[model samples]
Target: MVVSNIISGYQKTQKLSVAPFRQMQSAFDRDCLFTEKIYIIGYSFGDKHINEMIRVAITHNPNVKIIIIDPSYKDEKAKKAILEIWSDEIITPQVENMKFGEFLKQQIK
Candidate 1:
C-alpha cells in the first residue's frame, strides 16, 4: 500500500517558499476538522513542522482521538509538546511503542 500525492513543498534550490507550506497547513487543518480519529505511525516523518501541524490538528479537533505508534518511543517529544499546549486537560491520546505488524494485529482488532 504505497500511496502518494504531488503537493507543493521544498524545491531543489534550497530556498524556503511560503506558499507550499501554507498549502500543506491548510490541507492538514481541513483534514483534522473532518476526521474523528487520527492514527499517526512511525518516526519516519522526521519533521518538526509536520509534528507541529499534527499537534495543531489535535487542538482543532478537541474530542478527536489520536493513536501514535512509534517503536523505541523516541517521538515522545512530540506527544509531550501536545500535552504542554493543553495543560491540565486530558485528551486521552494513546502512545504505543510497537512494531507496525503487532499494532495491526493487536490494536486494529
Candidate 2:
C-alpha cells in the first residue's frame, strides 16, 4: 500500500523521503514470504528489496505461484533475473504483457 499510495502522496507534496521506505519494504517482504503465492498486478518489481523477496519465494517455495500481469515488464534483464531465480523446475504461473482486464478477458475466453 505504501508503494502505491506514495505516488499520490508525492503528487501533493512533490517530494518524498526514505523514512517510511524501510517499514513498507519490510512489510512487503513479510507478505511475500508468508503468502503461498503472489499476484503482482501493476508492480514493475524494480525495487531491489521486493525483487529479493520474489527470489526468496522462488528459491524456497517451488509450490508458491507467481502471477504477474504487467505490460511494462519487458526488460530482458529483469526477466532473466526472474527466470534464473525461479530455475526450471517450478511451473511458471500466468504472466502477460497486457492490461489486467484484457488478460482476464482472454482467460475467460
Clashing pairs in 1: none
Best prediction by lDDT: 2
RMSD of 2: 5.8
TM-score of 2: 0.58
How do the predictions measure up, each by TM-score?
0.58, 0.58
Residue-level lDDT of model 1, residues 1-109, one tens digit each, is: 3323333365512222345645655677688767888787764444555556666766676778888787766645655645554344467558788987899899567
Native-to-model Cα distance after best TM-score fit, residue 22 in candidate 2, in Å: 1.7
Worst 10 residues of 2 by lDDT: 7-16
Q: Residues 10-60, candidate 2, lDDT per residue (tens digit)?
A: 233222234465566567667777788688788755454456678886767
Pairs with backbone N, CA or C atoms under 3 Å apart (clashes), candidate 2: none
